[model samples]
Target: MAKHLDLEEQEQLDEIKHFWKQYGNAITWVLIAVLGAYAAWNGYQYWQRSQASQAAAMYDEVEKVSREGDADKLQRAFDDMKSRFASTAYAPQAGLLVAKTLYESGKVDGAKAALTWVAEKSADAGYASVGRLRLAGLLMDSKAYDEALKVLDTGMTEEFAALQADRRGDILLAQGKKPEAKEQYLKAFKAFDDRTDYRRLVMVKLNSLGVDPLADAAAPVAADKGAASK
Candidate 1:
């Protein structure tokens, strides 16, 4: 019986050895691939955190230079941030800050350049929209009406729809297209909430164009009521 038990144990051991011999290399490679993937993912996470930390520090530098109102320093800081961290949110933000400082310092061309860069290259749509709006204003001030219109025609966030329409109206008014300007202003007037003072300003614009938004709104209702009576 002891001999039989020994034989049984040896047979089990031989079976395990045969299985290991057949599948050992494949199992080892599969484990290595899994562990390598985990390590690569961890490394990628660390690299992203490091990049964000560096970008935040650079953005702080840009903010500091911007507050000092030093155009040269602001430009340098912004350039560095753009070159090194263009993928980060801070890059476009820094560009906007630098543009504001440049514009305030009477550097119109430089301000436009910075704004153009942000408008064209910003990954965030919101930042791009802001860049386009400000750039359009600058273009409008320069009497580049066609260019300003082109900028305003770009895609924007829904929240900026009313503001963009107003801007388009301003551009059209500058170009002496009163009818088209009035149409845009009407769109803007209706887009704004009644409770907001902005809507009142829009109303003033509509009135200046010889069109009363309130009257127009009432006209349809009055016509509907007349039809109902008839």
Candidate 2:
């Protein structure tokens, strides 16, 4: 029985050796690939975390210059942030902050440049929308109505649809295109939520154009009532 057991153990050992001889390279390669990928993922996570920490510190530097209203210093800080950490969310935010400081410090051209960077380079759609909106407003201030409209058309998300329409109305009104402006105001009025006070402001705009969106809203109900009576 002891001899039989020893023979059986030797056979099992030989089978395991044969299996490893056949598949050892393939198994080793698979493990290497998996472990390499895991190590790379960990490295990426560490790198991203490091980037965010540095970006936050840099943004605080930008905020300091912005608060000081030193457009030049703010621009320098923003430039550094853009160069070092453009992929971080802080970069676009720093751009916007720099633009605000530049504009308030009487640097209209610099403001436009900074805003343009945010509008054109920001990864977040909401951030891009805000950048475009502000950029358009600045262009409108310059009486570049067509260019402002063009900028607005570049990208405006659904959440800002009503604001985009309202802005277009303002630009049209500035261009003395009252009829076209009224049309845009009508669109804005339609887009605004009824519960929002902003809708009331849009209502005022529609009323100024000799239009009443709420009155039109009541028309449907009136028609329904007439049908019921009949």
Candidate 3:
């Protein structure tokens, strides 16, 4: 029984050796490929983390300069960040801050330039939309009616549609396009929930233009109030 067990063990050992000899290179290559991929992924994650940390530090400087209302310093720092870290979200965020500071400081041209960069270069749709909205406001204030309309022509997101419509109405009103303005106001009013007081403001604007949406609904109530007063 001992001899039989020894022969069986020897056969198993030989079988394992033959298997390794046949598949050794393939097994080694497969392991190397898997390990190589894992190492590359780890390196990529580390690089991304390092870049984000550096960009965040620069963003702090940009925010500080903006809060201090130093337009020149803020512009310089913003240029540095955009040149070195334009792909980061912080770059566009810094641009927005710089634009706001410039706008508040009565630097309309500088503010427009910063906002244009954000509108053109920002990878985030939300940031781009914000830049466009603000730029449109500045253009509207300057009576660049057509340019303001173009800025708002980007087709706003659902969250911004009502505000965009309101702004568009203002621009049209400035251009003396009263009918277009009224239509935009009606769209804005319908876009908002009935419970929102903002909707009431839009309705009032429409009413001022001789298009009273609530008039039919309020007619009976107005009559009742009149009867009570009488």
Candidate 4:
């Protein structure tokens, strides 16, 4: 058989060759980039899962140690989680647990340190907010009023706004600043939803201050009724 193609076939073969010649390298590079990105994404997912699993195990150890009332062992376990898997959600959870346990065990400084780490170092914003709030409360209990106020000022998210305001009011009341305390309580009352038990507590605080939340609105109605009678 002859090696040469017929006219139509040769022209079609030439077009195919030209097409590949123009696009072949570009197609290969695009495929390489896509595959590389897919592989990297899968690797990252696997790494995240591994980190979470290991962190969870460490947290379980911390919990057990806390239950056994071995504060030293609990601290060590928390330290491991913080050092090795701080990127995982479980690490922050463990930090909170450790702080609570330490505080209950009368380890005030240890509790403060743990909360500080979660506040300053945790990647989760919600956890950071919790840490900041708890830290502020501890500082207030220790009578570091200005320091507590400063801690409360930063890093709390809006979801914790009511609690933050209420805590500030408590600190102010502790310092004998009744006017400032009432102002903060009013803010907390407004921030907390009406149905929440916490809001009821705020209402009680306002009542003690002789400022009923509904009183302002009721005053106008009572005045209107009196004027109408006159």
TM-score of 1: 0.87
lDDT of 3 by residue, 128-185 (tens): 8888888899999999999999988984567888878988988998899999999899
Candidate 4 wrongly placed segments (more than 4 Å): 1-5, 220-230
Per-candidate Cα lDDT values, in order, are: 0.92, 0.91, 0.88, 0.91
Write the number of the candidate with greater lDDT, choosing between 2 and 3. Answer: 2
For each candidate in turn, the TM-score is: 0.87, 0.94, 0.80, 0.91
Model 2 C-alpha lDDT per residue in residues 27-140, reported as the tens digit of each score: 999999999999999999999999999999999999988888877778889889988998889988988888888998899999999999889888777888889999999999
Error of 3 at 80 (Å): 1.5
What does the lDDT read for residue 208 in candidate 3? 84
**Which window of 10 residues has the lowest lDDT sum in candidate 2?**
65-74
TM-score of candidate 3 against the unseen true structure: 0.80
Q: In model 2, which residue pairs have backbone atoms overlapping below 3 Å?
A: none
Residue lDDT tens for model 4, 132-222 = 9999999999999999999889888999999999999999999999999999999998888878999989989889989898786489999
All models, RMSD in angstroms = 2.4, 1.5, 5.2, 2.8
Instruction: Tell me how far candidate 2 lies from the true structure as C-alpha RMSD in angstroms.
Output: 1.5
Candidate 3: what lDDT?
A: 0.88
